[model samples]
Target chain A: MSSTREIDALIDMMAKLPGLGPRSARRAVLHLIRKRALLLTPLADLMQTVAVTARECLNCGNVGTSDICDICTSEKRANGELCVVEDVADLWAMERSGVFKGRYHVLGGTLSALDAIGPQELRIPRLIDRVSTENITEVILALNATIDGQTTAHYIADQLDGQVTLTSLAQGVPIGGELDYLDDGTITAAMRARKSL
Target chain B: MSSTREIDALIDMMAKLPGLGPRSARRAVLHLIRKRALLLTPLADLMQTVAVTARECLNCGNVGTSDICDICTSEKRANGELCVVEDVADLWAMERSGVFKGRYHVLGGTLSALDAIGPQELRIPRLIDRVSTENITEVILALNATIDGQTTAHYIADQLDGQVTLTSLAQGVPIGGELDYLDDGTITAAMRARKSL
Candidate 1:
């Protein structure tokens, strides 16, 4: 081993993270060791705190430090609109735009029949309950443009057919996107959704 | 914030690592949270332990969880052959090869004139002390092939002129390298050091 047992173990765990490999993990571990007081200790303390306190909100399935997330409990976010997403990451991307003033419903994953995943496998049941009881006016299906995502969105739209208004994000050439580099499906969608000048 | 304060802080700290950015940091933190019991808690505990115990070897500059590293304390490694490297990471790489069963001397960094760093800025003085006292017969300059590395090696060779035999790593094609991809400098060095086939 290039390092001690404890250090090696730490590097191994870091390597298992999403973007880091063995070499980068070793560099990161060395950096953390050099800046022990500044980075390593505080990161360790923060990880421990998050581990003990972080949980998924019961209402919207969003991750937070309590049973109900801040967005779910805040009155300003009770704008009668609930945006449905495939994961917390999608919900976070939506929140980063700062254009949405309503709460979110995290589905955790889409309904995948090949994987034996159904509505109950995800948080779809809880989403249905929230739409019926929360006095929601509209449900936005801001899912990815994947087959599974569209299938899940269609299923949710069917379930809430007469309960409230159903909508989805518009598909078009993204801002700063070039038509030459776009895929055929995207180009076709943009052509069909063309608007007046 | 998409998540709680603690989670966001953790993500921010993770982003400061060498290979991770904000998006990847968020993904890593979310992974850590999902596997809190199996990964997060243990990693946090290990970081804490390493932060408290890790230190630089007094004799050499190798990092370990002690005042003097295991290599410095091992009697069988006293083979009168000292390998000098530029950093603790280099020392670890040397050890990983499982060759060179002697000892090591880490210089912390090379002497850089532009940075106003001299022999005293590195561990050159300590290396000289070890050559006189450690009964070393050969000193291998395992420095890098960079300009500063060569300059430091030449300086060290001059410092220990007649005391011990001096040598350096060979410059040529790497083990799995191809001729088409080899640089002109490396090809010239390989030609100069051509072996009798």
Candidate 2:
């Protein structure tokens, strides 16, 4: 607030970010101003570039710079399997692990009756189309374990009943999880689905 | 990383900001991409403008769009009282509170022995000159409560001992702070400086 209107406006916009509040926004603005050449200028340039070029992948609903995403177009990716996630962020998370070599189907969001979001609101139709046209043999539901997420997974499974082999992510103790710290549902799931050691 | 190069780069730069980790930065970048028209474009434009216009006030060391800040040029503010802080952020914090109606002197940073930073590294010399030239009657040290902050305050106090009245912000329990969560030093200070009920 002591700075000019432009600086204050920058702080206000930065504060609206997911994890950044007013306090951290101020710190970030100060840091950006101090490291203008190394951070601010480049950040501004990239933001502008992304603002102009970024678009949703028409085939999978994933965000990218082209009409079709890299994963959808890459011939190296496993074509028989498709990983379905509720959001583009989840798809990115799976990619970061470098485990799943197959392409992804971004649902855009989970089904929510309260919010009036159904199969039509998301990319369910597109996902079904990709499965048949892209020769997908298996559909892996990588949705979160939330109630709405499970509801969405079930709905998708019903829609694709006999068309493909469907599976959801395992629900159990996380890696490096402490038994005492885990919730009751997690502990029960972990115990019920105990694997052979 | 599944996103485009520019988006991934933006997320990387955002992760470097204070209080934002890689996960949150990814979320923020996605949100910006989704709301490009409403948030991203304006933010980029404003950042570019601030990058070019923001500068240190010649007299006060405050970050502003002009050589001399608005506060420094304002005759309405109390001229006899000068508040000194370690950074422009602190000056902005004071301004947000809207408590002190006086000009400020930003020290840039504290006197850090480990970093070999002394009075010359900060705006201590400028402060001394301003005290005499500006006819300052009182100098309030609004530096942080850290060890280095106290050391810098002592150094400044010594320099202006006889010339002007010197004072520093009080240290103790903060407003709305619970006694159970307060540290030993804070409790001791509060008890020593206890006031009549």
- For residue A197, what is the lDDT in candidate 2? 79
Candidate 1, which CAPRI tier?
medium
lDDT of 2 at B47: 91
Give me the candidate number with maximum lDDT. 1
In candidate 2 chain A, where is summed lDDT lowest over 10 consecutive residues? A1-10
lDDT of 1 at B24: 95
Residue-level lDDT tens digits of model 2 in B49-130: 9889988899999888999999999998756999999999899989989999989999999999999999999999999999
Q: For residues B82-101, what per-residue lDDT tens digits would candidate 1 score against the true structure? A: 99999877887898888999
The Cα local distance difference test for each model comes to 0.93, 0.92
lDDT of 2 at A76: 90
- The TM-score that candidate 1 achieves is 0.93
